[model samples]
Target: MTTTRTNKAWASNALAFATAATVTAIVTFTLHARVAADETPNSRPPMPVAQTQYKLQLSFEREQRFLGLIQAASRSQIGFEVPGAISEILVREGQAVAAGSPLASLDTQALVARRAAAAFDVDRASAELELASARTQRRAPLVKSGAISAQLFDDTRLAEKAVTSAFAAATAQLRALDIDLEKSVLRAPYAARIGRQLLDRGAVTQPGSAVFTLTSIADREAHIGVAVEQAQFLEVGQIYPLQWRSQSVRATLLAVRADVNPISMTTVAIFSVPADVEAFDGEPVSVSLPRTEPETGGWLPLSALIEGERGIWTVLALRERDNATLAVREAVEVLHVSGDQAYVRGSINDGDLVIADGVHRIAPGTLVAPISSSSVTLAEH
Candidate 1:
C-alpha cells in the first residue's frame, strides 16, 4: 500500500513539472513576439537630409552673351594714283599717320622733266600769241590801205587765229602735266593707321597697285554676323547693351543685310560702337542682344532636378502636417537654366519647398526628415 502511494506521488510531481515547463515556453514566446513587433518598424537608422525653402523675388534672368572678334571701322588699300618708279617710302609699318600725310614718293625726275617741258611750252605759246597779235594788228592797217590783198589779209588773220588756238591748247596741256606731277607724291586720304609697306625706294609700281593698307579707327563700328533666325527679330535703330573687357557700352543697330550668306546662312548686323570704346577695324568683341523682356518665374536649385521617363523633373515637398514632411513628384517647365539654378514655371508656388538634397533616393510620397538651415546650401541663380 505504501509502494502504491509513492508511485502516485511521483506521477503527480512529474505532471506538475511538465506543466510548468510548458507554461514557461509559452510566456517566453509571447515576450519575444511583443519585443519584435515593437522594434520592427523603428529599427532602421534615420537618413541624412537637407531642406530649403523656395525664394520669390524680382530676379533678373541671366542674359546669354556671344563672343565676337573686334574689327576696325574702315579699311582701305592705299596705292599710287599714277604709275611711276617708287622713289621714297615715308612711313613704316604699324605707324600712326595723320590725314594727307605723305606716305610715299614716286620717281619725280621724269615727272619734273615733263612739268618743265610743259612750262617751257606755255612760255613759248605766250610768246607766239603776242607775236601773232602784233602781226594781226600790223596787217589790218596794210589791208585797209590797199598794200595787201583782201585774200592775203584774210589768210594772215586765219593764221593768227590758228596760232592763238594752238597756244590755248598748249597751256591746257601744261596744267594737266602739273597736276600729274603733284600726284607723284602720294598722300594719305584720311587719318589712319598704316599697315605693311609693299615697296621700298626705287621699286616700280603700277597704278592702283597696293602700297600699304590703311585703316581708320575713328568712330569704329562693330559688325557681327547674327544667325538668320535671330537676325529676323532685329530691327534697325534698336539699341543693344554690350559689355567689352569689363567696360559697359551701348551699340546702336545701324543696319541689317536683307540677304543671308550662302555658306554660313547668317545675316550681317552692323552696330555702331561708341567713339570712346576704342575698337580696331576688324577686331571682334562680345555682343549682348536682348531677345525678349524678363518674365516672372520660379527658380530652383539645379540639384532638385530628377531625370526619368518624364524627362527632367523635380520633387516638390508639400507640408502635409506640421511635423511630417511629404514629397510629391511634379513636372516643371524650365525656362532658363544657368549656373547652379534653373528658372522654372510649374503648378507649385514660389515659396514651395523644393527637394534639392536627397533627390536620388526619395520618390513620390516619401517621408523625409527636415534638416535645419545650417545644413542647406542656398544660392541665387
Candidate 2:
C-alpha cells in the first residue's frame, strides 16, 4: 500500500512540472513576437504638403469701404408768388430749363382788365393836374399884381394843391397794377431739370404752394458718412476716387459737417462730383479709404490656420528631424483676416516653412514631403 501511494505522489509532481514549463515557454514566445513587430519599418508613406515661406511685415493697410449717396447741389420746390387759377403749364416733368424760362402762367384776364382801368385813371389824373398847374400859375401873377384879393388867390392855390395830391395817388396805383401783371408768369430762377409736376393745367393753386420740383443739372454732390476718426484725415478741396455702379470716378472734397448722423453714427462728408460724369440723383455709391494699422505681423493663407484650444489659433510649420521634414504646431495671434488670407504674429520666425493647406490629414510631428510654393505671391494686406 505504501509503495503504491508514493508512486501516485511522484506522477502528480511530474504533471505539475510539465504544466509550469509549458506556461513559461508560451509567455517567452509572445514577448519575442512583440519585439520583432516593433523593429519592423512603418509601411505608411510620408504625406506631400504644400508649403510657403513666412515674411514679416511692420504694418498693414486695410481698405475700408464707406457707403454714400449721390445728390444734386441745388434742389428746390418751385411755385408762383401770386395765387390764381392756372391757365397753362409750359413745362413737363424731366424737362431741362434755363434761367428765366417760363414754366407756367396764371389766368391774366382779370389782371389785364384792372391794368386798363388803372391806365385810364392815370390819364384823367394827368390832364386834371395840368389844368390845375395852369390855374395856379395864372393866380400867382394876379395876386402879386394886386389885381385880385389875397384871400381869393390863396384859396385858388390851395385848391390846386389838393388836385395835385389826387393825381399823384392815381399814378402810384397804376404802377402797382403793372407789377401784378408781370408776376402772373412763373419762370425758372436757374438752370435746372423738372423732377415732378405737382399741378396740371387749369388747376387752382394757392400762393407759395409747390407746383414743380426743380433740381439743378449743372452741379452734383456726394454725401458720404464716415467714422468720426476717419473723417479727421480728410481735407477739404482734396480729390478722391469714388465708386458708382462698379465704375471709378473722381470727386472733390467740399466740406465736413460737425454734427453726427443719427442713423449711421458717423460724420458727414460732402464731395462735389464732376459735371462731365453722368450719374442720377440719390444713386447708391461707395468709397474706399486706406486705414493703416500699426501691428507687426506676417500674412498666411487661411488654409494654414487650425483652431486651437480656448480660442487660440495654430499653424503647422515644417522642421528638419531625422533627415526628414516633420510638421510642428506653432501658436499665432490673428490680427486681421481679409479675403482668403490672414495677418498673424506668433511663434513663427521669418524664413520658416509653413504648411499651406490640408492640415487635417496630419498630426503634429508628422513626417511630410514639402512641395515648395515660392512662385505664389504672399498676401499684401
Q: Estimate each model's TM-score.
A: 0.69, 0.71
Q: Residue-pair clashes per candidate, as listed? A: 15, 0
Best by lDDT: 2
User: How many pairs in model 1 have backbone atoms within 3 A of each other, for residues 3 or more apart or on separate chains, i.e. clashes?
Assistant: 15
lDDT of 2 by residue, 1-381 (tens): 999999999999999999999999999999999888775545357789999888898998888899999999899998888778999999999999998999999998988898899889889988888888898888888888999999998888887888888888888888887787788898998989999999988888888999999988887999999998899999999999999988999989999999997887899899998888778889988888889898998899999999977999999999998788899999999998889989999999998889998997889988898986864456666
Q: What is the C-alpha lDDT of each candidate?
A: 0.76, 0.89
RMSD of 1: 8.5
Question: Model 1: per-residue lDDT, tens digit, 26-125?
Answer: 9999999989987773553444457666665554446556555556676889788888998888888888889889999888788778878888888888
Given candidate 2, what's the lDDT at residue 314?
93
Any idea how many clashes model 2 has? 0
